[model samples]
Target: MLAAVGALIIVFPILLLLLNAFKSPVDYANSSPLDFPAALDFTGIQTFWETQNFPRALWNSIFISTMVAVIAVVVSVLNSFAIGIGRVRGRTWIVLAFLMANLVPQEMLFDPLFQLYDDLGLLSNPWSVILTFVVIQSAFGTYLLSSLLGTFPKEILEAAAVDGATRWRTLRSAIVPILRPTLSVLMVFFFIWTWNEFLLPLAFLNTSDSLTVPLLLEQLNGERQTDTTTLIAGTLISVIPTIIFFLLFQRTLTRGITAGAVK
Candidate 1:
């Protein structure tokens, strides 16, 4: 009861944006900002999508986020197995260093990254964004998967080894299958985070051809004041992919979140 009320209070602003997406500009202005639209209409939304090159932005976002997730996940899984199962002598220190790295604010890293990419002639390149998101997400994914792998029952790995499995094969066939829930959490998170990330994209992406959804939304809102409804429409459109992605992975995410609660 109280929880429902709190949830509403938290998301009411977002609800308003959704409601405004379908409202006529005059109705948007004259009516209660919170009121339902007089007529269920999508003309403003259609116009916004048509004018804003949202499809291109959306595609760019999908590409960037997918690359980030796949690359990060692959890198993380290998490294996590290396440090967790292999148990190198200094693994603890390395894991601590990674966790500490995660504490550094992302804003502080962009300038140096931009200059490095500029020197490498990668400015305005999608790889620049894709690689940046991968780097940002890799540390967390490694730490997460390492924690899970380190604690996985030793018997399964031993059984695989007895069956003539090499370490890499055991990791591939045994550990990875067991870690799907946790991996899904990281995959879904990296995708959504990269999709919504604005700062690094804004700093690095200089052209319309590489603009992502967040950057496009920012440009649209910045370009006109009267397009509040249009901007609202754009935001709602932008969120659809993220919502769908989350829904598809909700079970894995829920399990990942609750997996460690008792431990």
Candidate 2:
């Protein structure tokens, strides 16, 4: 019961957003936080979809997030193999550098990143956002996968080498299979983070056509203040994909985290 209550508490904001998406501004303002919607007001959803160019935003978000996840996973897996298996010189230092990068607050670097992108003429491009997510996520992913790789049996790698398997072949065919659960978890996490990222996209992208879902939702709130229901509805729409992804990978994520911790 306590755990259930705690879980509800954690999810209360999402619940509120779901309810408000179906509520009028007046209803939302007048009702208690726990109260249900007075009626099923989906006009807000319709308006949000039509006015916000929601389909375009959704596509942009999906494309960027998918690209980021794939790139991050590929880079992380390679780096982990080098550090954990290859016994590369300066591996410890490389790992420490990634840790430090992760420690640095993202807000501190946002300005520099924006300027860099501006200088490169990448502002408003989908690839720019995808690259930003990949860079930001790579440090964490490398750290995570490296730690898991440490627990990997080195003898098996040596045995494969003895059987005439090259290092690259061993990593792809043997190591990656064992790392599937970990990679699955990382994929889901990176997807969620990339999809939900707001600050970077807002700062770097100016064109409405390039706006992500979160940015679109923010625009809706600012321009359509009187239509709070629509804003809420838009918020709900933005979160749906994240919720679905989490649900799909919940088991793999839990198991992966547990296994990584035990190792």
Candidate 3:
């Protein structure tokens, strides 16, 4: 019941937004906050598509998020493997350093990074956002994957090694398959974080061509004057992909969290 209540509380705003998005502008403005729409009005959605150039923003967000997730997961997996499987010297200190870095406010890195990117001619480029996201996300991903790796049975790896399998062969044949669920969870997390990230993109990207969905949503708030419904519709569009992603990865995410707890 408590979980149900929490889920309801979390979902309520999204449900309200969806309802409002289908409401006519006049109905949305005039209706009570709790009242249901008299009829579904797709005008808001139509207007949003016409005004927001949502397709371009959607494509940019997808591409940027995919790149960030792929880079972060691959780098994190390698780092975790080194620390966990390779048993690198002073690995604990390296892990602690990454943990400390994660504790730092992400916003604090923006100014220095912006200056660096400006110098490097990366401002307004998708790669700029991609690389920044990879660096920022790597700290957490490494920690999570490392913790997961710690729980894995050393006996299995040793047994494989005793059979004369090389370290690379052991990892490919033994470790990666076990890490799949955890990797799925990380992929979901990285995708959501990269997709919803607003500040970094806002600070770094100056061009509309590079603007992401979140940035475009911010733009909608300005463009949507009388049509509050259109703003609601735009918000819904922004939220749908996240909801879909969560639904798709819910199993792996839950299993990953549980796996971490066991460790």
| C-alpha root-mean-square deviation, candidate 3 | 2.6
- Per TM-score, the best of the predicted structures is 1
Score residue 222 of candidate 2 by CA lDDT: 78
Score each candidate by Cα lDDT: 0.85, 0.83, 0.84
Model 1, residue 71: distance off in Å is 1.4
TM-score, candidate 1, is 0.89
lDDT of 2 at 192: 80
What are the models' TM-scores? 0.89, 0.86, 0.86
Tell me the tens digit of each residue's lDDT in model 2 across 119-155: 9999999988888778778888899888778888978
lDDT of 1 by residue, 75-185 (tens): 889889988888878999988887765788878888999999999999888899988878778888888878878888999988998999988889889998888867877
Output the TM-score of candidate 2.
0.86
Tens-place lDDT digits, model 3, residues 148-203 = 78778979988998999987888778988888767777887788889988888999
The alpha-carbon lDDT assigned to residue 213 of candidate 3 equals 89
Model 3 pairs whose backbones collide: none
Residue 227, model 1: lDDT of: 72
Please tell me which model should have the higher lDDT, number 1 or number 2: 1
Candidate 2's clash total is 0
